[model samples]
Target: MDDGGMPWATARAVGDRGEDLVCTYLEGLGWAVLDRNWRCPDGELDVVARDGEQLVFCEVKTRRSTRFGEPVEAVGRDKAHRLRRLAWAWLEAHGQRGAAFRIDVVGLLSPPDGPPRLTHLQAVA
Candidate 1:
């Protein structure tokens, strides 16, 4: 069976590619990436970086098409809450408690035959 449309492995690969693209895009903006695929009991953080003096936890949503909706629309309030909790866990794990941080969402629409489109939203929650 397929996940949504693509197989599970294919979907995961696409998501990974999207995260890679987001990481490069952030680096291009001069952000130093601290981690990728950081996971805890609560959940996983797609990307973590330092933007100037602030820490950023990025959630990546990738879609092969927008037939259902925009990729960013995938992040709902529940997901945002989970991300916030995961951010705290990450900070604690890295001995960065009480650090200034924000949540960001990177949405990628990767068409099968065209270049991927990226959208970055900062301070989402």
Candidate 2:
């Protein structure tokens, strides 16, 4: 398979890097990251953090090139719904069911030889 013109391993590495960048960025903003790559039967939540009284569930999308579309464009209605469900599952599992929570999307465009560009969309769902 073409794998979108990048090997699976390379693609995974790009995504991991994006998540790492987002985590550092969030921490720089004084957000405490509670969990990362949190996975359950439903799916995975890339970065889960606490900002003041709100819990943020962030989805990270990264690409080496925006040949198809912007990274944030990947999260459509279905993906948003999945993130919501995953967030709820995370809260229940951690005994924080009643906590104020919101979904966020972090999009990263990492070119072959340049500083990556990041876009954060808060309260997406």
Candidate 3:
């Protein structure tokens, strides 16, 4: 949990837990997770998976509550554009041999009092 500071350790832990859950859910849906927390000079991608013929670059946002806004609301157009660029860089760096590629976002809302809710938005970018 290298969250840059101890104050954010809990947030980091929650995010990590959410990512694990999302990965497991994706696997159950028959998607093979090719990478987790893949990084480059630009930024980091939460997850990359092979869904039959398409390569999916996923951005995951986890939240403990909706006090500010929903998890999906966190990713805006600018972020989506950045994610697309990152995806291209990933494909290029990995040899650009995939069938096709798309950007997706997974929003997780894990409340302390109840079950976590997951929202998978495919082809967001």
lDDT of 1 by residue, 32-124 (tens): 999999988887999999999999999999998888788998899999998999999999999999999999999999989999999999999
For candidate 1, the lDDT comes to 0.92
Which residue runs of candidate 1 sit more than 4 Å off their true CA positions? 1-3
Candidates 2 and 3 compared: the better one by TM-score is 2
* Residue 15 CA displacement from its true place in model 1, Å: 0.6
Estimated TM-score per prediction? 0.96, 0.95, 0.92
User: On residues 1-125, what C-alpha lDDT tens digit does candidate 2 reach at each position?
Assistant: 11287887887888888899999999999999999999999889999999998999999998878887889988999999999999999999999888899999999888989999999999989
TM-score of 2: 0.95
Pick by lDDT: 1 or 3, better one: 1
Per-prediction RMSD in angstroms?
Answer: 1.6, 1.7, 2.8
C-alpha lDDT values of all predictions: 0.92, 0.90, 0.89
Give the 10-residue window scoring lowest on summed lDDT in candidate 2. Answer: 1-10
lDDT of 3 by residue, 43-103 (tens): 9999999999899999999888887688888889999999999999899889985548999
- Superposed model 3: Cα runs more than 4 Å off: 1-6, 97-99
Cα-based lDDT at residue 57, candidate 3: 93
Per-residue lDDT value at 33 in model 2: 97
